[model samples]
Target: MEYNLEVAELEKKYSNFHLKHINIKLPKGKIIGLVGENGSGKTTTIKSILNLIKYDKGNIKIFGKNTNNLTKIDREKIGVVLDDSFFAPILNVNDINKLMKKFYHNWNEKYYFEKVKKFNIPTNKPLKEFSSGMKMKIKVLCALAHEPKLLILDEPTNGLDPIFRYEIVDLFADFVSNKENSILMTTHITSDLEHLVDEVIFILQGNIILDIAKNKIDNEYGIIEILPENISKIKKEDYLKCLKYKNIYYILVDSRLEFQKKYPKLEIRKPTLEEIMLILVKGE
Candidate 1:
């Protein structure tokens, strides 16, 4: 598989905090969900990859070339959507088009216009007049207008409504449908990405707790809700993680066969990505 971004030993430190040595690869033709709590280094990792922050140690390779060595043209091939817009609040959509056109060698005005129309984003209105969701849509349109081979998104679904979130997720799917384009999206909203992400990369306390194929995780892991009395009968090794919610015991098991054979009294259930993540992150 061709990798779009390779992060090896990526590290950064501040006076009070340190984004410890991190490693992960974003492959082409798939959507990777970079998930973690608010302070789990998700944004820091993204910044390191984009060279927005100075790193102490590590090498990030983008499109087979080190990220530190990427030229202007090479850098333009990757589009990014940060948490906020770079455009002035008073600027209209046309101003953004002109600015980005001058900035990107491969900017497509026609494509941009088509996307704006599809999303019903008003070009005549100033950006400050747009709603949060509309502004997000504009950012997304701008990212894709340049025909980038890789898309890097940070909290792309942060403030959008359910309807628009679904629409944007479909947009991302369309973006990566060509098999040459790839996306690395970091968001706390895991359900919005449930249908889109091909791989899952979980970051916790500056460390990657889980990095695996989405299908493999789903196929191998299950949520077993067992009685509090029967919890002692189940082997700890059969489970990846477990939790207790008031009266119910939520156990996460990788192999159901062993559990089924060992504990017939337990009830096995399919788990959502959010459930798996919550349990893994809880560490109990």
Candidate 2:
């Protein structure tokens, strides 16, 4: 299969943290959401793919070429926006615009200025004076201005309000409308992504524990609420994981069909991404 980006057996280690055997693929024309808690190695994974830090060992490829040998053409096809702006703090938006035109061969002047206006960033003020959200918007603006084939974003919506967040997410939807474009974004805002992503990859403490299509969760994954007496009716083998409360059991089932077959009369509800994350991380 043709993939926009791929990582295999990726390993990275620090004093107190380790990312082991990380493997994931971003296909052409698809948006994949990377969801995890604060210290789950999301940023580390992204950095590793971009070769920003030295990974212990692994294979990372973009557009069919190994990242180790990424050409200038390959680099040009990818846009990246991280939590912190990489631009010089002393430069204003206009100054950076003039400078970036010399940097990217395909920089779109109209699109760049349009994004600045759309984001309401101060044209003359230094980047250091912009708010966190404003800085983030400017960073995204720069990334998108070059019309890259792939976008790698880390925590893109963390500080923005609802309106800007929704607008940016919608812009992402439009970007991937072309089959050649794709995105791999890590975000804590699961709600914003529930309807936007094609695939959801859940990473926890550096390991990828869940990888599934967004639609499959609604049809295949489910949660069952049962009283203690009925717990045995739903076989232990049927549920992926579960937790018990005062007088009830909250069970997470891998197959809703199996869950329904076991408890035809019981209630099973659609579990949200957040709930699944919670159950996986906090449940027994």
What's the lDDT for residue 68 in model 2?
A: 86
Task: Score each candidate by Cα lDDT.
Answer: 0.87, 0.88
Please provide TM-scores, in order, for all candidate models, with all chains considered together. Answer: 0.95, 0.93
Pairs in steric clash, model 1: none
lDDT of 2 by residue, 1-284 (tens): 68999999999999999999888899999999999999998999999998999999889999989998999878988999999647889999999899889989999999989888877889999988988888888888888999999999999887888889999999899999988899999988898788789999999999998999989997889998788887777666878887776677788887888778867888888988887887787677
Q: Give the least accurate 10-residue stretch of model 1, judged by summed lDDT.
A: 256-265
lDDT tens readout by residue for model 1, 94-167:
99999999999899999999888888889999999989888988888888899999999999988898988999
What number of clashing residue pairs does each candidate have, in the order they appear? Answer: 0, 0
lDDT of 1 at 154: 93
